[model samples]
Target: MEMTKKIAIIGAGPGGLAAGMLLSQLGYEVNIYEKNDRIGGRTALHKMGKYSFDIGPSALTMTHVLTSLFMDCKRDILDYVSLLPINPIHTLYFQEVTFPLYSDYAATKAVIKTYFPGEEEGFDRFMKENTKKMLYISPLNQFNYSSLFDFFRPTTLRAIPSLTLGRSLMDDLARYFNSKYLRLAFSLQMRYLGMSPWDIPAAYSIVPFSEFYYGTFHPIGGQNKIVEAMQQVVTENKGKFFFNSEVTDFELEGNEIKGARLASGQVIEADYYFTNLDFMYSLGNKPNNHLEKKEYSSSAFMLYLGLSIVLPLSHQSIVFPDNYREFSDNTIHKKILSKDLAIHITNPSATDNTMAPINHSSIRIMVSVPNNTSAIDWDKETKEFRQLILDTVKERLDFPDLDDYIEEEYIITPKDWEEKYHVKYGAVFGLQHLTRQHGFLHPSKKLPKYKNLFVIGAGALSGSSLPFIIENAQITTRKFLQKENPSNQ
Candidate 1:
């Protein structure tokens, strides 16, 4: 008779939750430990009176990732979570002009012809080329790289030229879009990776293309609902979730992790451990002393507002600064906080009535900023930044008295992300996905010296996108399963 393997998972983030469900269904005794009082670390919901706001990932693209997970369990995604379509994906507002991008190819082309005239041909070529690039790159993301040379395989070798190896995301966009603002519009999707278009590799050009191809979505309740659905799946599969249970350190035997020490002075032992924490934060007295030398993604200064009155805005909108390139370089490279800022706002009340009370709005605003490595002091700058954000919103978004209807408000700074959430340096998206960081080069390496130890999350393969994180969890799970049963390998 075969004995069940005991699996210990740290952190209750999306990846952790998904891994729990997947492993539990396969007959493993899974236990997920979360530091917070609830599930969904960054994807958690914050309630302010009658308003419900998502702490992270307001929009959902690549629905098939979630669908595939549910289908694997012989269940339907819709039965677990209701996903609502977001038409005209998002409204992009520039200093001088504004336009909405549609998922419909013809409709989007029409908008391009109207706003960015003479660039329709560029849009066509971009879609055609990126579709091919996605076909090549998507499969690579699904692989579990055991070594750096795995990237040199035929599949990766064939993708070398299309990978935009030496070029930046902005460079790739410039090849298609003539207008700088249109390019900025396309490149803003890089923010999801917590990277600047000028720095992240051109292969990420697939971001905007995926948004246009697969479209975007929102859960009926909030982004948190997806995690709630996953939680239910895990629970039904006999997985146990321990809330407010924090893992302080791991007891190591040679290279294998023996047990996880919790904050309450209790140690939990398991045959296999899957740490879902940020990779940088999980390291202990390793070669890297302070982790100061490592490259991290940009952090965010977020504002969650519950307003008594709703704003006449789309479900999702972004306000780009006057000079996007300079703004990007200053914030991401020089670590300078400029007056010209790019603000991403999500008003979920417009699409889902459950987000707020009748006629009210639950708005989440995210501003990309340098991680904690910068000398910027959030304790002193938060109030000023809040004012700047509100002022900019009122002016650019055409809301003269946007502050009048605020019934409640919350602000999360980079400092808060570090102290409260334990994200290393408050880099919410974990490590930056630079060109060299792809495949086995990523810090979220699958094969660690400790054979029983594994990692899954934004800190893992690819980057911080929700779909990639889920796919990474799936791939990591597959690798682990195959190792346990050599026949599967």
Candidate 2:
């Protein structure tokens, strides 16, 4: 009798967990090792005195990506987690006016009309064009391509009229509407990928379509509930999860990954290994020359606040300064926190009461800052920076004595994230989603020197979104299984 193959997955983030679950479902014996005590790398929730906040990825878009994962397992995602649609997905606050982006096209258009009355036709045209762009790029997202050149082939060329990476997202919108407020509202979605609209490829315009078309969703309990659901699937498939087990080194035999050595001085061997840890970090303490040559993504500074009083703001809000470009430049070049920055405020308790104490609220304020490696004095700077942000939020939103409402607060500077998550440079997203580093040019599952080793998550193809990471995991597992067992195919 042929023995069942064993697979070891490193990291318990969504990608690693999803990969382990799928492989186990395919009848392989899988073991998942997570360095952290909990699952969900960046998606984990941090609890304070009376508030629970989603430490990473505050919003959920592209529900179909998640649903497809459940469908593949011959189950429904809804059975695992309840998803609630959030209409007017988020409110964009600018110096001039505030606009709500609704799931319904008509409703969003009407909101736009309220501010720019005569520009309804323009808004409609822009949406139509944006939708066309999404339809064109959708195929690339769902399937694997051989190379960057392949995207310019005849079939892809046919869609070129709809695809536009030649211009920035801001420039594309500038062609449609002259209002800075409207422009800011639409372009703020670029920040979802930690990019600036002024430099981000227009091809990314599809981001808004994903949210508007599929609608933004929130898990009923907390973001961590999704992690629990993924874990359940893995457990149901007979996969073993080893939390708080840090992988210290890879046991290689003749350029093939034989197993891994844990920080606890134990060894776990497997036929194949899948790593969801940050690509750079997974290369072991002393990396080979090639691994060291690769680049990394931008880091972030996040502040999780548990308010003593309920905040009157919406579930999601982006407070933009007059000079959004300066903020973007500061993040990209200076690696400094912008004085007039873009702030993403989320009060999950508004949508799910379990997040905070009765009549209280939970809020998180995120600002793109330099990676931890930068020479900024976070120890000395954190207090001053937090105060600046608080002052700015109070003035912009006109909250009455907002400082008094803080019952408990926790801040994750880039240094904290780097030390905790092993994310090189404290980058939340594994790699930058630039034109050169996107799609096919992104890292591949097949390791350069190791035959049985593979990579998954934001560092690999499909880029750094929850849905894409999950998708990449599924794709990598399927490919590996097919390669290892031709009879199964």
Number of the top candidate by lDDT?
1
Off by over 4 Å in 1: 277-284, 446-448
Q: What are the clashing pairs of model 1?
A: none
In terms of lDDT, the poorest run of 10 residues in model 2 is 288-297
Candidate 1, residue 45: lDDT: 90
Compute each candidate's TM-score over C-alphas.
Answer: 0.97, 0.93
For residues 55-116, write the lDDT of model 2, one tens digit per residue: 88877888888888888878799888988777668888788777778888889888878888
Which candidate wins on TM-score? 1
Candidate 2: which stretches are off by over 4 Å? 142-155, 277-297, 443-447, 487-489
Model 1 over residues 198-295: C-alpha lDDT tens digits? 88889888889999999899999998999999999999999999988888878888888888888899999999988874532554635553335557
Residue 177 C-alpha lDDT in model 2 = 82
